[model samples]
Target: MDCGIILPSVSPNSNYFSVHASPRSPCIMVRCQQKEGQVKNNHHYNELPLLKRKRPTMINIPVDRSLENNNIMNTSRVRVQEVEVEEDGYGVYSKKGISRTRLEDRYSANFASDAHGKSKQALFGIFDGHGGAKAAEFAAAKLGNIILDYLRRGDKSMIEENIKNGYLAADEEFLKGNATGGVCCVTALVQHGSLIVSNVGDCRAVISKAGVAEPLTNDHNPSREDEKLRIESKGGYVDCCNGVWRIQGSLAVSRAIGDQHLKQWVTAEPDTQILTIKPDFQFLILASDGLWNKVSNQEAVDVIQPFFTAGSNKPELKNACRKLVELSISRGSNDDTSVMVVQLDKFAH
Candidate 1:
């Protein structure tokens, strides 16, 4: 990662400010465990009837540049495509927020099982940085590749364990740096028809299955009952300030990638969920808190559903992704916003 700080350098007369963030400015740390001893059953996902497979090939989605002429796409910042990773099974899109906050969000997606000479597998992740972009940036640049390399080593049974180790590796690597900041993250890994979703902090992953919306991860906010219990059990305290629940009246989340100062409280652990990819699964959504803070899960599904059903390609999907981010800004999200849309079963039928 480059050590140079990327500050806003847009021309004064320009209407837009170029946006940039990378592992260049993020932090890393992790501590995960599966909560057990709970007998209560959570409501199951809404399943949809499978329709006949009769659609044409889905279009190739690309980065949406509709805002290029807007006040946020100035020449001072490198284009989003410079960091986007798109291919056959997935597409990722990210942009700077309308806020003056550093462009501290980062994302990654990879779907090349052949490269590893194994059964098909895909990995996707999104990180939202705070303090600096170091944690998010570091995870974005290294996490998925680490998992992929681990898988290539022919040890696939302990998927959750392997992923946790990967997060730990990222955390250890980031702690070695001099940067001071942290990042929240969410990841979706699909292999052998199984989908595993893992997350820390508020960034989220939602899936649209047969027109119904299903959230894959929970936000680790300080106020969440379970999160609060976990923090207090660890000898930490939570407080409410100005309508927001914060850890020790400072951080808003209970878990994150990096925060050396709060390492004892703000854990790096991620909650994990596993499920088989059903035929009804339509698309998967991953995004930073900026978009979720302004949009509801159902609302997002409603806005992006039509595009998927219409056999949308790369550019169309890119537009859909861009539309969601723009919507967040319009809805008053002053934080950096990033979104990724992965059309499941895109190669099917």
Candidate 2:
């Protein structure tokens, strides 16, 4: 069985050259198999001339490693869904897990520059969906823009309020769609040397300060005392199911953007904070529970430190993000993993 771009099988008798098939973009895999009689009757191979080589030869072909790496990262059970890199600052990587038959993780990364081409602001988000991918996909595509629009209308002092409003606004829009399921979210906004971080679910943001890991947002799980109290106060219940605590015996997260049935208890109001970007800040990591459940915050920072700490204007952040997700998968996480890495120094100015 072969997988790649949709193409008809080549006739061995007519084709004098080799045809190499590779996936250029996200594509479907189709298996083309010949029947026993077809293979037995085909004499095309015998008609082709063969030349013996004394040794091996290196073929000089320009290759796009981004595409190649994406393919190489996929396994029979796991699929690499997305790989995006902005050499100027950040990169993102997401993969479907072995336990899940589909990918339910989505992400967004946007950077704004000033008239002089200087980096002025950056936005990063990770959305992890449960029940379905619709909520995550909707939030990933629409939340950043809504938040940035709010930020444009306010000053740094109002960053917190703007971010919160953005989350609520996006939630309202999504709820109007009558979508089922919900998405855990984490967003990082950088502007005027201040890093604003926000979250409403298990998605997390962590920053590396001179090689030390500092969490920017806490997971809003039903297991938390505050979260549990909030849910119960709203006439909801929290129960432990199979060793995992869940709200109302349904969702594991206490807050999110959708899940209309649980909207009253599972609010979309994000906890927001602002931190001044300093020289000590190395980089920031935004990821879903897929990575956090398996990899510790310090472990994640340590694994990617060498890449950012290297004195290079263009660090290999793409590879760094890829390695982090791979590490999580290796650690027995059977959930979709998404990771985004941003070099702090790039936006420090």
The number of the candidate with the highest lDDT is 2
Which residue ranges in model 1 land beyond 4 Å of their true spot?
1-87, 115-119, 152-155, 311-315, 347-349
Candidate 1 whole-model C-alpha lDDT, 0 to 1: 0.72
Tens digit per residue, CA lDDT, model 2, 1-349? 3324333445644432333346443333333344434443354533322222223333322111332112112122333355445456777777777787667787776667899987688787888888878888788778998999988886756788989989999999999999899999998888888888999999999999999999999999999999999889989999999999988888899999999999989999999988999989989999999999999999999998999657877888878988998899888988988888888777766
lDDT of 2: 0.79
Model 2 lDDT at residue 158:
78
Per-candidate TM-scores read: 0.73, 0.76
Question: Pick by TM-score: which candidate is best?
Answer: 2
Mind giving the per-residue lDDT tens digits that candidate 1 earns over 1-349? 4423344333434433332433544422222221243222322213221222223443322343321111112222332321243455555566666553446787776556466565376777888888866677677777778767766664668878777777776776788885688989998888777888899899999999898899999999999999899889999899999999999888999888789888888888788899888889988999999899999999888888888777545436666777888898888888888888887786332
After TM-score superposition, the amount by which residue 128's alpha carbon in candidate 1 deviates from its true location, in angstroms, is: 0.6
